[model samples]
Target: MTAARAWWARIPDPVVDLVVVAVAVVDVLVSLEDSSRLAQAMAALACAALLARRRFPLPVFLLTLPASLMLDIVFAPFAALFTLAERSRDRRLLVVCAVLFAVASATPWPLDDLSSHDRTWTLVYFFYTLATAAAPVLLGQLVQARRDLARRLEEIEEAREHERLLHSQAVLARERAQLAREMHDVVSHQVSLIAVQAGALQVAARDPDFKEGARTIRSLSVDTLDELRHMVTLLRASGGRATELTPQPTLADLHKLVTTSGIDAELTGELPPDVSTTAQRTIYRTVQEALTNVRKHAPGATAVVRLWHADDGDAFGVTVTNTPPARPSLPLPGSRQGLIGLRERAELLDGTFASGPTGEGGYEVTLHIPTQSG
Candidate 1:
């Protein structure tokens, strides 16, 4: 029953009005038992008035009352009453309209022939008709209530979805704040100490080679501390920056990064100036991670940082290759997430990342992104 009503409700308003008018015409024709020309004209007007019931329900209903009184008709007045009941919020007005309909339906026309008993029967019939008139009003009110409920439920669902999104964002912000604190308090402090110790070692060392190594360590430690402070600041900003922070590394900064990597590394090749900031960041991180891996696992290896664009003009990328370690490398703590992260970044840009050992006992990391990717 509910499904059927839903289907019925989906019918267009104009179409429903036409159907009602047609039904009322059929009802009038069925009851038009040799009525006078005036009665016929009133019946036609009542059926026509049903067409405008949705817009002027009260006036249309009043127009139908005269036809109901002079002739035995039902549908035109009922449709108009239902429409008025669906739209009107005044209960008293609805009650009055119902009473009027009942009176029109019960009272006999042409007041020349009447008796006391006939008047009593007419009063009883009026009450019965009043009760019957309540059916359409109640049904129309039910439809109105159902529509209001559906609209209210939609609003509640939207509010809940918005609240859930806000809660998730709050949780993410808290996590970022905690991570920033840990990096600032622990990692930054330790790196600062390493820089200080390396500086002391560089000044005290007698051997030229030892002095150079200490100086390199101090420089790298200082750079790491600078980067750590920047990261901490960004995380603590809670995803909104009050001012422009330090600029991120791009291909232009690649030269400085390769030179300070504490290895015999060479930077080469060039890409289009139009590469997106996100793509540039991805390339920079790829080179940074590749060099870090070489410093830890391939000690004393010479690395070649080559940026290139495909001849077909479809893609551009970088390749970082390192020769085999000249000596055994020291064991370093690592999470092994660098390659996985690089792969994910490439995937996001609809690109490709590959890392493997070369036949010449060297390691190579390559990244290629489409020219259109951002």
Candidate 2:
């Protein structure tokens, strides 16, 4: 039943008016009962005036009133009264239209007849007149009330949905801050200790190869510690001076990032002459994520990083592709959230991201981002 009513509601007003006109025409034809042709035509025309009721309720009601005296179709005045009452919130207009409908519908029956009849019959006719006139206006009022209620309910539901989303975001934010603190307090400290031990070993070792290896480990550990601290600061500050709190790596920093990944990375192309910090950061993260995946999943592979202006200089593009691992090695532990974060970052900028095997048993990640110019 609801589905059917919803479908009916979808019908346009003009189509609804046409359907009503057809029903009114059929009603007039059925009740002809020896009425003159002119009377029938006037009745049909009065019913047709219902189409204009929405646009000009009072004018159409005035048009349909006298025609009711000829054909005596109750609905013509009733429909007009309904429309007038529904369209206006003005009590005076509604009352005036209701009185007009009563007068129009009860015509050809003398008001003085009430005085000649018994009290019982007089009361019956009086109630009948008032009831017929009031029914349409009352129905219109009911419909208006339902519509207002529905609108308010929708608004309240929307507000609730907004509040729920905000609450979820708040909870997620708190959890992220807590996680950042843990990483800094526990994991970063441990890594720094390891780096310090490697530095001590590098200083004391006699063999040049052992010293070189220790120095490499210490350098990598120190870089990791610095990045971890930067991340924690970023999370703690949240909305306040993020870039100032911890510097975000831009395209200019790709050389150092590639070097840290322990892979021979070839970088090409340039960012737009004047790019936004956001676009630059997104581009940097995309490359960073791709490089991290390589180090974790395919540690010994060489990578190629490419950057180019796409879409006629309206957008920037980055491509990172690496060959499969050189030989078997211990798999690096990872939660593998880097690629997902990279994808989300691209989407936030209305950009595109894709990563998959290159059909050569090699993995490739590609990103396209819009620059400030576009």
The candidate scoring highest on TM-score is 1
Per-model lDDT? 0.88, 0.75
RMSD (Cα, Å) for all candidates, in order, is: 24.8, 20.5
Quick one: best lDDT, which candidate? 1
Error of 1 at 193 (Å): 1.8
Please estimate how well model 2 matches the true structure, expressed as its whole-model Cα lDDT. 0.75
Question: lDDT tens digits, residues 1-374, model 1?
Answer: 87997798899989987888889999999988988888889999999988888889999999999999988887889999999988887889999999999999998975457799999999999999999999999988887777656654554465467669979987897898789889989999999999999999999999999999999999999999999998898897774334356356677889999998767999999998899988998999999999978876786689999999989889999999999986444455678799999999999999999999999999999999998885
In model 1, state the lDDT of residue 352.
96
**TM-score of every model versus the real structure:** 0.62, 0.56
C-alpha lDDT of candidate 1 relative to the true structure = 0.88
- Consecutive 10-residue window with the lowest summed lDDT within model 1: 239-248
In model 2, where is the ten-residue run with the lowest total lDDT?
A: 108-117
